[model samples]
Target: MLKIVVLVSGGGTNLQAVIDGVKDGTISNTEIAGVISNNKNAYALERAKENGIPELCVSPKDYDSRELFNEKFLEAVDSFEPDLIVLAGFLVVIPAAMIEKYRNRMINIHPSLIPSFCGKGYYGLKVHEAALSRGVKVVGATVHFVDEGTDTGPIILQKAVEVEAGDTPKILQRRVMEQAEWKILPRAIDLIANGKVTVRDNRTIIAE
Candidate 1:
């Protein structure tokens, strides 16, 4: 079985989606080994506890520098010995060392189609706000490998959602989540866990 470790920093809605997918047979051949959060009070920790998965809380503030925190963070995550690391609403930049070690072994779900409304400063409602401000006719979600560059990883899967005229940031955020992120993230996880995805030349080739 593929063992997965999830990183989160919020209510864990995406984390829940993965859990539900695993439970409902939508995602198979995977076990969520653990969940790690930077926020001690993050509800994601509660979700992990409820599911009987090992949970770890490591605050960046505890460390004097981002470098130190990165070391500790990588150590904590590697302790679980996960075959795959899923960044589900994890709201921080992963350390370069960790990214280098993990390589294609880690993945993240971004709330935009990527290459547009992605990269630094394009997260949470800001992505939707930017899309709306740009008067985009469509918005979507992307699941990609976590690379050294922000959101510039090889795309594993993408699902687009229409942007309605009257959509506010919050409303658009919910729509994208329901229509895209919730679906493709688990699907991408399943693909990777099942060995249906291959990375080559900084791109992904999904096997048929």
Candidate 2:
């Protein structure tokens, strides 16, 4: 079975999606090894505990520098010997070392379409606000491979939500997240696990 470690910084809706998928056979041949967070107060930890999965909290403030933080983070994750790492609402910028170590095995689900409303300081509600402000007819979420840049990895899957005229950030986010995140994240993971995803010149090729 493929072992997975999830990194979360907020509510674990996506994490829950993964868990439910695995349990219900939507995602097969994988086990959630553990869940880790930078914030001790993160609600995701409770979700992990509820599932009887081991959980760890490593505060970035405890480390002297980004390098140290990355080292410690890697140590915590390495303990599980995970085959893949999933970032579910994790807020920190991953260090290059970890990115290099995991490389294609790391994935993240962003709340908005990439190359649009992404990068540092563009997370959660901010992404939704940006979409509404831009008057985009469509808003959606992306599941992509994790690289050194913020949300710039090769895309694996995306699902769009039509931006309604009266849509508030919250309303738009709710609709997009329900369809995009809960659906695409698991599909991306399944694609990787089944060897149906390949990176060709920085693009994702999903086998038909």
Candidate 3:
């Protein structure tokens, strides 16, 4: 069995996907170790409560310094000894120290195709807004290994979604979540949990 620690900040729609997958045995041989958030009021905590998973809230504002905040957050994460750390809408930027420590053991599912509507200043509805603004015919999701940079990690898996006409950011966001994000995320977790993922020279080779 694999132990997974999930981090979230907002509504936790992706977190719900993971939880449902585990409950239904779609993601077998895995147990959610815990869920942690930077915002105590995050609805994700409520989701965790419903699923009977432990929750940790370590808000960045509560700490006097960035280092202090990172140290405390890492401590909570380390306590679980998670086999995989999934960033499901966690808003905090991971420090280099934590990135190096976790390395390929951590993964994040971004809302749009990587190398496109990603990087700093691109998140939530903003990503979809950019896509619509640029008129990219297609948009999707990417699950990648977490490196120090923003969404610049080694690509693991991606699913594409067509940009429908008359699509607002909210509409596209919902579409991407349904058509891409929610699907590949848990599937990636399952592949890693089942010993089917391989990292080679900064790229992931999925075992078929």
Best by TM-score: 3
Query: Which stretches of candidate 3 lie above 4 Å from their native place?
Result: none
Off by over 4 Å in 1: none
| Residue 117 local lDDT, model 2 | 94
Instruction: Return the candidate ranking by lDDT, descending.
Output: 3, 1, 2
Q: What digit string (tens of lDDT, one per residue) describes model 2 on residues 87-201? A: 9999988888889999889999999888889988899999999989989998889999998888999999998888988899998888987878999998888777778888888
lDDT of 1 by residue, 97-136 (tens): 9998999999999999988999989889999999999999
Question: Ten residues in a row with the worst lDDT in model 1?
Answer: 91-100
lDDT of 3 by residue, 1-208 (tens): 9999999999999999999999988888899999999999999999999989999898989999999999999999999999999999988998788898998999999999898999999999899989999989999999999998899999989999999889999999999999999999989999999999988898899996
Model 2 misplacement above 4 A: none
Q: Each model's number of backbone clashes? A: 0, 0, 0
TM-score of model 3 vs. true structure = 0.98
Q: TM-score for each prediction?
A: 0.98, 0.96, 0.98
User: What Cα-based lDDT does every candidate model obtain?
Assistant: 0.93, 0.90, 0.94
